[model samples]
Target: MELVLRSYCDLRLLLLLLGFSAGAVLSRPTDEGKEVWGYVTVHKDAHMFWWLYYATNPWKNFSELPLIMWLQGGPGGSSTGFGNFEEIGPLDSNLKPRNTTWLQSASLLFVDNPVGTGFSYVNTSDAYTKNLDMVASDMMVLLKTFFDSHTEFQTIPFYIFSESYGGKMAAGISLELHKAIQQGSIKCNFAGVALGDSWISPIDSVLSWGPYLYSMSLLDDQGLAEVSKVAEQVLDAVSEGHYQKATQLWGKAEMVIEQNTDGVNFYNILTKSTPTPAKESSLEFTQSHLVQLCQRHVRHLQQDALSQLMNGPIRKKLKIIPEDHSWGGQATNVFQNMEGDFMKPVISIVDELLEAGVNVTVYNGQLDLIVDTMGQEAWVRKLKWPELSKFNQLKRKALYSDPQSSETSAFVKSYKNLAFFWILRAGHMA
Candidate 1:
C-alpha cells in the first residue's frame, strides 16, 4: 500500500511539471521595464529612427498597457523633433515633468519616418518616397521588422496616432497593416487609429477651406467666389492627375485666405501670433532636453538590429556613408508634389476601419482653420456608415468646465465605433 501511494505522488508531480512547461511555451515574454531606441531600415539606403517609451508604471504587467505609435504632420516633418518635444513627451518647455502626459498609461513611440525626417536619413536620394503608397509600404516594413525584433510587445493593443500630413500617412499605413495581419505576415494585435486635425480626403478637406473662411466673415462674397474658383482649378488639376499643380494652386488659394483673415494662426485662431524670444530657439531647447533623456537609456541599441537580411547588405547593413549632396527630406517633399493620387479620398478607408470594429477618435479644436471642425463634421456626416443619418442628427452635448480642470472642454458626439470631440477655443494644435 505504501509503494502504491509513492507511485501516485510521482505521477501527480510529473503532470504538474508538464503544465508548467506548456504555459512557458505559450505565454508572451514580459517587457515591463524596458526601453528601445533604434532604427528601422526600409529601403537600400533609407533608415527610420524610432524611440519607444515604456509605460511609467513598470510594475504593472505588459498586458494592461496600450502602445501608441505617434506620427507628426508634414509630408516632410520630423515626428521625433516636433511631436515628441513640442506636443507630447515627459517634459514641458520649463524642463519640468509634464503633469498629464500620454506616457502615464500608454507606451508611446516617436519615429522619424520617411527615411529623412529628424535623425532618420537616406544614403541615396533615389530611394526617397515619392507617393503616399510608397510611404505606406516603407512604414509597413518598418512596423513588421520592429515587431519581429520585439516579440514581447506583440500582444499589446497597438494604435496609429497622427496629426496633419502624418494623419494621411497613418491612414494609408493602417490599411497596409490591416492587410498584412490578415495575411499572417504581421502577427501583432492592432486596436485602432486616432487622427488629430488630419489632412484626410483632400476633396472634402480642401473644398471647405474657402467656405470656412467665408462663414467666419473673414472673406466677402466676392473674395469667397474667387477662392472657390481657385479651388475648382485645384480640383481640375487633381482630377487630371496633376498633383503638383493642385498642391501649388491650393497653396496660393490658402495664402489668399490667410492674408484676408486676421493674421491666421494655424495653432490657435483666437490668439494673435506671439513673437518668439530672440535668444532661445525651440529646437535648441528640445535638443538640450533630449541629450539627457537619451543618455539615460539603460542599454543603447544599435542600428544593425533593425536591418532585414533580404539583400546582401543593402537591407541588412547600417551604412552611414554620407553623400556629397544631401537635402534632408527635401527631395521626398519635392517628389510628393508630383504624386498623382497622394491627396485622394480617405473617408472610405476610415469607414471600413469603423466597420471592422476599430475604435476611432477624431478630436479637433473649434478655432482651427487648416482642418476646421466644421469641415471635419461635414465630411463625417457624409461618410456611408450604418447610422450615418442618426449620427448626423445626434445633438452635440456642451460641457462647461474650468480650463484648468478639463482644459476648455467642448461639444462631443459619438456614434457606432467612432467619436468626435470639439475642443473649446482651440486650433490646429488641439
Candidate 2:
C-alpha cells in the first residue's frame, strides 16, 4: 500500500489567525497502518495544522533517508494542486489507474500556505501581509512537531524543494532553520535544496530572459531588437526614477504573444491541460472566441486574478483604479513590488543559510516571457559569487531554446555548497 502525507494551512481569520484546522489521513492500506492529522501548536496562542501518512511500523527497518518538504509558489498557490497533479501524484495519464506515490524511500510533505490562499484565511489585510519571517517561524513550529511525532526523522537530513514564488519561502525558511540549528535553539538535520523554474531575483532575471528568448527564437531577431530597445528605455526610466513611464514601456513589450493559426486562442497558447477523463463535454471553438477561449482555459486565474489585484473580497471593498494606463500595473510590477516588501526577509534568510554552509539552488525556465527570464538572470548575476561560473549546455541547444520545460536550454553554476540552474524553455512553475 502507498503512504501519502497531506498537510493543510489554516488562515484563522477570526480567532486572531491563531487556530488551524488539521488535516487527517484517510483510507489507510493495512490493519496496522496509521494515518493522522491535527494541529501543531506553535506559539502560546498559535497553531499550525498538518496531516501524516505512514505504515504503523514502516520505519521499523531503518530511518536515514531524506525527508523532503515541497512548496509550490504563487505566494498563494496550492502544492496539492500543481505538485500533485503534474509532478508526483498516485494518479497519472488523466488520473487513470497509476500508483506513482513513492512513499517508502523518502517522506514528502506538502503544505498550503500564507493567510489568504487555499482553505487558509486571515481576518484582515494587515494580518495577512505579516511577511516571510512569520511564515518561516510557522514552518519551524510545524516541522518541529513533525520531528517530535516521528522519532525516526529527528536526526535525518531533510531538504526543501520549491518552485516559483516558493523559492522566496524555501530560501528564507532554510536560512531561518539554519539559524535556529546554529544558535542551539533547535536541532535540524538539513541537507540541500532543489528549485525548479523559480523566481528568486527579478531585476537581473529581466536581463537574462532576453538572451534565452532570442536564442530560442521565442523572440525573433527583429523582435529581440525591438524588445532590447524597449527594455533599455524601461530600465533607464526605472533607474532614473520614472516609475509610470517605465511600466508603460515594459507593458508595450510585454503584451506581445506569438501569433498562430488559431489567432491567440486556447488552442494557440501553451498551457497545461489533461485529456478529459472519459469524455465529459463537447464544444466547438473558433478564433473569434479568443477572449472567451482564454477565459475558459485559465479559469483559476480569471476567477481570482481580479480579487488578488483588488486586494480583498469583491463585496467588502472596491479598489479605486489608479490613473495609470494599466490596472494597478499587474503582470509587470506586482512581483517586483511584492519581492521588495514580502520577499526580502526570505532573501536575507537564504543568504544567511548560504553563509552557514547550507546549499541553495535557484533556477528559472527560459521561454517564460510572462515571468520574464531576463529578471531571473539579472538576479543571479548580481550574486557575484566568484566561485559561481556558468557552464552552458552544448548538446540539444534547440530544446534549450524551446519554450517547454521538458525541452529547453540550460546552464549550471556552483558556489561552495550552492548550485544554481537556469532552464531554457519553462515558465513560472518551471
Clashes of 2: 22
Q: Taking the tens digit of each residue's C-alpha lDDT, what string does model 1 give over 212-263?
A: 8777777788878876877787789778877655665655555455555645
For each candidate, what TM-score against the reference?
A: 0.74, 0.60
TM-score of model 1 vs. true structure:
0.74
Per-residue alpha-carbon lDDT of candidate 2 for residues 1-430, written as tens digits (9 for 90 to 100):
1111111100111011111122212232323333344445454433333434442224432253456677766555545334544444333325453333423334556554543333233333344435566778877777767776777666866778786667777876787777777786666688767655555653344444455566644567766665566567656765676554443443333333222111222111244233222211122223233222222322333234443433333212223222232211222122222322332313445555666777776655544544455565455545544344532222212212222345324555544666555554344444
lDDT for model 1: 0.62
- Which candidate has the highest TM-score of all? 1
Distance from true position, residue 52, model 1, in Å? 0.4
Scored by CA lDDT, what does every candidate get? 0.62, 0.46
Q: Which stretches of candidate 2 lie over 4 Å from their true place?
A: 1-36, 39-62, 92-99, 102-105, 229-253, 256-351, 363-378, 384-386, 389-415, 421-430
- Give model 2's TM-score versus the native structure: 0.60
RMSD of each: 15.3, 13.3
